[model samples]
Target: PAVVNKIAAGEVIERPASVIKELLENSLDALSTRIDVDIEEGGTELIRIADDGEGIPADELPLAVTSHATSKLRQADDLFCVQTMGFRGEALASISEVSHFKIRSRTAEDHVGSELAVTCGERSDIRPIGCAPGTQIEIRQLFCNTPVRRKFLKRASTEFGYISEQFTRIALACPRMQLSLTHNGKSVHRLPATNELTERLTLFYGSQTVEQLIPIEAEHGGVRLWGYVGHPSLNKSTRKSQYLFLNGRYIQDRSLQHALNEAYRGLLMTGRHPVAFLFLEMPSDQIDVNVHPTKSEVRFRDQQFLFRLLLSTLRTKFLQSD
Candidate 1:
């Protein structure tokens, strides 16, 4: 069982950035209004996430690290409509399998908090402590025991770059959540909760970049799309700026990309991609997010309809601006 967990951990945690992504998702799942992420040595030496959300009860601290123990899914039907971010129940368990994990949590009912520590799948300690009314998780020496895995890690700078990108992606998806990131004790990003999408974009990109974008809002056939689409003059050499969120979850889909590009056809230069941050909202039953373990790809029931809706919406926006 231990060996199996370690193997699964490798799949779920490809690198230090992967670990940060899982931790951020878990924090978001906790309904945290404010989340702080701190990392060192590209997250290999240490990674910490603190969230101001509903903390776990003292009794549930131990079980929280147990395999397949999740609060997100109450029944089988919940799988079809997973609105929460961390539902698989495998993230903490798998992460603890290969790292030194510790969690301190205090619920509103508790006067004091409880702390649990696990070292590479073995419980080291569990005790009561003083803490704020929330959860703080610290992971250290990630992949230290797995020499082969550690060998595959990139340099600290390169790995940190990936971590930064992941942080931006999560921040973009949840613009109304207060999020901050620190690396080696230096502040990387500090974003306060705001309902304005353009404000969040300005924080990542500059004010000039935001000015180059055009607002998009449209609703049709039980689906709604809203966000900022870059003008043709603001096209990029890479598609990194193209972000699509379906039902509050960031996703990558070729069909949606094709639709977007088609909307920009004849407007953009060859080999250039338009910058966009689009959010699509529809009934949860109309799409499926369980196709992949990472939940980065989703399947829509009516792909053609969605494509047409996106294309037409962007085309109309472009035409109006012109």
Candidate 2:
């Protein structure tokens, strides 16, 4: 249905940062070692992302922005066993629906790459362009066609904060990927590829915050969680610093949050929130990521069991000084 495209677009590209997140994921999936993001006015006016990765092929250029055209997975079974960060392939199509979009992609084999432009899901131009051996996408006037969605956006500074936070999490997950962020031509963050996870954390959270982080690892009952958690003394005044990734996929689960809160019950003062970057790995079939449109929330078959395990492990780590 024609309406389904618009609905899919709404799910894939909710806001500027949501667009930014999907594009960044594509760059990472492309095996890009370096990604540079440049934004103007919190990515509402303009957002440019450049990545030095294996670019899209010439023949695949048109399909890149077509609805449901994805190279991430092939069959329905793949959906039940997704290992990559993004698989729906709806990102580009959705992005094109709300903004002025342009993509310049060149694989290493192709002598020249193609450039395509679309405004509100309508293609205006598609031609060959001489570019480097990589992909560079530029999005402008996000949600300009959808005035209602545009109104939901926050202030530029606030939106930029969310964009920056998402970038930080993605970078943390792929420590080997070098990521840089610039706003209005001024560099806000520049992180070169580093093998050390601590360095990446320090670059994002500052040395003091990084110093307060503790490594976390727990495995039992076909589930494994690993990452860093903040010391009780390093609790934040808000829950913004908490990150939970299920099966290498970033997710927001209230049950997991409750488990964390339970673990910190005796250690943290009231109104304090603990900072964490925990990743839970399990069989993909056991967790349903499609439960949410944005793919930020998940449904676990045994959510209670997962919650209790998280709570017990976190509490034991502190009690036993593990």
TM-score of model 1 (CA atoms): 0.96
Q: Encode model 1's per-residue lDDT on 1-322: one tens digit a residue.
A: 8889999888888899988888888888788899999999898898999998889998898888988888785443244332566747888998888999999999878999999999999986679999999899999999977889988999987988889988988899888889999999999999999999899999998899999999998898888999999998998999889999887777888899999999999999899998999998888778765576575787888999999999999998888999
lDDT of each: 0.87, 0.83
Please list the Cα RMSD from the true structure of every candidate, rounded to 1 decimal place. Answer: 1.6, 2.3
Least lDDT summed over 10 consecutive residues: which range in candidate 1?
Answer: 74-83
lDDT of 2 at 298: 73
Model 2: clashing residue pairs? none
Q: How accurate locally is residue 290 in candidate 1, as Cα lDDT from 0 to 100?
A: 53
> lDDT per residue, candidate 2, 1-322, as tens digits?
5467777787677778898888888887788889999999988999999999999988888899987778875443244332445647788988887789999999999999889998888886679999999999999999887788889899999989889978977877777888899998999999989998789888877899999888878888889988888888888898778888765457788999999888888788788898898988888667664564456777888999899888888887887663
